[model samples]
Structures are given as structure tokens and as C-alpha cells.
Target: MGKSRHEKRAAIREHKEARRDRCESDAYLDANSRVIKAERNIPWWRR
Candidate 1:
């Protein structure tokens, strides 16, 4: 199943927090953000 609303929000929030922390490398953050986008767009049934 696709991510639930709570899961999606959590993932987005986690990514935002990571960006704010500035601890991880830019490449890592960029890749993570891309993953969020990819997962977020998936249809529930398809997931």
C-alpha cells in the first residue's frame, strides 16, 4: 500500500528537520528529498 497520510507527513517532516540540522551532506539530503517526492506521488493501490 502507498504511504498513509501520517507516514507521508512524517517523512516530509523528517526531511525538513534534516535540512534544518545541516548535519548530513548536500548529496544525501538531495537524494532523500527526491525519494520523498517519488514516494509521495505514488497511488495508494499501486503502493
Candidate 2:
């Protein structure tokens, strides 16, 4: 049997929420890596 309209809507909402969460995590990781790289570049005397 085919899914009802409400069921289809719920599935789409769930998929969107999942995608948003993944994007947020990826952005966080990218920002964190940049910070770490910058810290590594700094010399001990300056830090």
C-alpha cells in the first residue's frame, strides 16, 4: 500500500532535520581544524 499524505510529510521533515544536523557538525569541525592549525603555526615565544 502507498503511504498517506501525513506519513510522507513526516518522512520529509525527518530527512531535512537530519541533513541540517549533519551540516552543523561539518561546519563545527571545519572551524575547529582552522583554530588548531593556527595554534600550531604560532611560535612558542609568541604563545
Candidate 3:
């Protein structure tokens, strides 16, 4: 069966929260600013 609209939105919200937490925890600790900036410059579609 297909999920209801509310369920879909809740799943998306949960995923976003998890991603935000992960990004916050990393916070440039794993890589330097130059590498991160280069990554950011790339188009999302290419990535």
C-alpha cells in the first residue's frame, strides 16, 4: 500500500534531521576548508 501524505512528510523530516546532525558533528573536523569548498563548488548532479 502507498504511504499517506503525512507519513511521507514525516519520513522526509526525519531524514533531514539526521543529515543535519551528521553535518554538525563533522563540522570541518574530517577535512580542511579548502577541500570542503572545492566539493561545494561541484554541481550536485555531477556528484
Give me the candidate number with maximum lDDT. Answer: 2
For every candidate in turn, the CA RMSD to the true structure comes to 16.2, 6.5, 8.7
Q: Give me the candidate number with maximum TM-score.
A: 2
Candidate 2 Cα outliers beyond 4 Å, as residue runs: 26-47
Compared with the true structure, what per-residue lDDT tens digits does model 1 show for residues 1-47?
A: 89999999999999999877786788878999999899989998988
Per-residue lDDT of 1-47 in model 2, one digit per residue for the tens? 99999999999999999988887787788998999999999999998
Q: Quantify all predictions' global Cα lDDT against the true fold.
A: 0.91, 0.93, 0.85
lDDT of 1 at 34: 99
Which portions of model 3 show Cα errors greater than 4 Å?
26-47
TM-score of each: 0.45, 0.55, 0.52
Please give the ranking of all candidate structures by lDDT, highest first, separated by commas. 2, 1, 3
Model 3 over residues 1-47: C-alpha lDDT tens digits? 99999999999999999988887666555566768788899999988
Candidate 1: regions farther than 4 A off: 23-47
Worst 10 residues of 3 by lDDT: 24-33
How far does residue 14 in candidate 1 sit from its true spot (Å)?
A: 0.4
Name the lDDT value of residue 42 in candidate 3. Answer: 100
Ranking by TM-score: 2, 3, 1
